[model samples]
Target: MSIKSFAARIFASHIRNKIDKWASNPHNTQQKVFEELINKAKDTRFGKDHEFSEIKSHSEFVKKVPVRDYEELKDYVDMMVEGQEDILWPGKPLYYAKTSGTTSGAKYIPLTKDSMPTHINAARNAILCYIADSGNSKFVDGKMIFLQGSPELDEKNGVKLGRLSGIVAHYVPGYLQKNRMPSWETNCIEDWEDKVDAIVDETLKEDMSVISGIPSWVQMYFERLIDKTGKKVGEIFPNFNLFIYGGVNYEPYRTKFESLIGRKVDSIELYPASEGFFAFQDRQDANGMLLQLDSGMFYEFIKVEDFYSENPERLILKEVEVGVNYVMIISTTAGLWAYNLGDTVQFTSTKPYRLIVSGRIKHFISAFGEHVIAKEVEQAMKEAVAESGAEISEFTVAPQINPKGEELPYHEWYIEFEQEPEDLDKFAELIDRSLQKQNSYYLDLIEGHILQRLKITKVPRNGFQDYMKSIGKLGGQNKLPRLSNDRKIADKLNEII
Candidate 1:
């Protein structure tokens, strides 16, 4: 093995051992630890002196602050963009992380020097815990690998800052920071599309062992990697040991990715954003046990139904029930207070607060009285495709109701596959059967027969990526909206149909 690969493997192995030690310890209660952190965050931002010098007494600061969101920090970000003092902290902000949030096109989230330690600590804990869980602490003794953003900076300051990925790229370990592939390799970099092709070219040459990013981008990368190498992923990257997937659910793409690699790839899911790295999956098979950076921020959970009902009740971590879906609200050290991310999750257990992603609350389809969640739809599709003895290359579902004055509303499935099914009718029936069995709403709608039918049409291969690229929003961080509940997406799909 090359010297760099050998070193990376060693580092990877070391990180795993550290994480295993932390995960197995009984004294680390996320709930208690994080609750203390929440109070610290409040004092830092809201104390009378605009400073967080001393906060030894927790009760003195617990209920003093109100929940905050991005709206509260609008002025703070505006100040930083103008090179003013940091509105969130005492000093000026070194960089800003940009993210596309719901109801807002793009939000510039400021990252301060004060919150740096929290970010580093949480991220390290996340990595080490994964290593312990995988029984692959030995792999850490090797060189480090990071699938990260571009290193380019702005011309004026010679500091290529401003993008969310770029801001994160700035914080990588100094020793391995130089190992990052060009920002151009990503289909994004804020403005420059000049070297999109070159970026893709150089990435194929790198010795990547640990890959990290949203599952969507990894999906696109594997497709390109397969085509370029003319060999399956297993043959090309035999040294690759871990695959870290975050930003979204990895369930839908899990089987597909595992099969392509030809071996079980150790994976880690991260719950991070431009705002902060809130939580990470600490155990391999424990879903995601939240390691509350109680020091970085405070969390509040609003029950899924209560969030939508006339009277909304937000619960504390201690009051949270297992198996109940809740909307996450976070108050961070940076600036955001009581910010609702709009994502939904359910607890697998509350003793440690392990959660399973339910779906985005706003991304549900309710046409024809058949409420379909993205998680349910994804699971149904996976089971359906498996049972049909067919492989789905790409697919999307658009809810079309009463088109051309029809009385019923049903889903229009756009499917694409490599090999045509020998029995197309059976393929359609299998998908329908899967949905009927998995989703209660779909089952009820089918029994009532309120919806006319579930229609499946084969589209060109890579059609999903084509759609994603057309929008200029393909790859990591950005995802193909599983449930196109908006009129624009629905109308666009209708046009394609």
Candidate 2:
């Protein structure tokens, strides 16, 4: 092994031991973090208003601070944005990780001095965990390309404002600077297509190994590389062995990605966001990402079914169970308290507190009370693809509650396929049956004729891409929602089709 690789093994071994200690006793680890966050932020405007000083226990804390999304907590955040000190946390945030909001136009999530290192460490530790497990550090010596947002940042008031990925770019370790690809100037290209072209030109001939990015954007990068060289990615980057991805599940794209690579490359999943780095895949053979119990954040979960109730029971790490879909709520050192991230996750392993992000709170279809989630649709698509020998590039689901004529409203699926199934109708039927197997409400709707069997709209090649591009959201940490509650995306998709 090279000198760096040898040193990496030793360091990874140490990190592995450290992680095992906390993972074994998750409740205590999380309790300490919870206490720290409460103490640290008690003097802030929000803390004072919520009576954080009187909160002595998790139950007390829950009663004092109601779970809130960005919109509900906007007043305090707005004060902080307007240069008020100690509004949300002690002093001002180090940066505002800018992101597109669902209801609000743009959200400025705080990244505090205390919470920033945890984000960086979670990413670094994910790789170290891989190295420790597989005993492979050879990839570190090769060129590593992180297809990410432009590092160029703007300032609002006194705080640096940039996309979470862009802010992370500024923190690339000096040791990896020589190994990182696509020079800074190329990354700063504002236009995503132009950026991909620049990236392709820069890394096409390099000894690229570790490629990290959101899966959809990385898929685009792979397509461009193949277009340019007319070779599988494996042939172009012979040493490329690891792909680290985040933001979206890769299961649906696995077949397409493997085809593009021409071989199987190991991958690591990350659960990161502007609020805090939540989890990362700690074991290659494990079922789900390891919850970061000690990452300066305290986690609470509400069963998805009970999430909308006026008084939902909040369960701490010790109270959660496997297989139950729960909406994640967090109180972080970054000053977000009882924050509803709007993402729902299901525990795969309760012993170590590992979870899979199953879906989103607001990103589901229930127009006629079918209440189908992203996980159900994605799994159905995966099963159908396996059985029908089909290849899907991208897809989305929406409730078509108002179809013309006497036709019954049904779930509309816009699918972009790389290879069309021979019997397209049978393929759709397979997907419908699989979904019915997973969700009973959906099954009831079909059985009762409240809705017809789901309809598939074969979106032309690059149809979803064109839709995303039309909305100026073509790349860089952006994800196509797997399902929606309304016809907004379904209508726009039809426009592109």
Using TM-score as the measure, the top candidate is 2
Q: lDDT scores for all predictions? A: 0.62, 0.92
lDDT by residue for model 1 over 358-430, one digit each (tens)? 6787777777556677767777777765665566555667776655674576787777665556788777777
Error (Å) of candidate 2 at residue 467 is 0.6
> Model 2 shows how many backbone clashes?
0
lDDT of 2 by residue, 208-234 (tens): 999999888898899999999899999
Worst 10 residues of 1 by lDDT: 151-160
Query: Model 2: what TM-score?
Result: 0.99
Every model's Cα RMSD, please? 4.6, 0.9
Q: Please state the error at residue 334 of candidate 2 in Å.
A: 0.5
Question: What's the lDDT for residue 392 in model 1?
Answer: 59
Would you give me the overall lDDT of model 1? 0.62
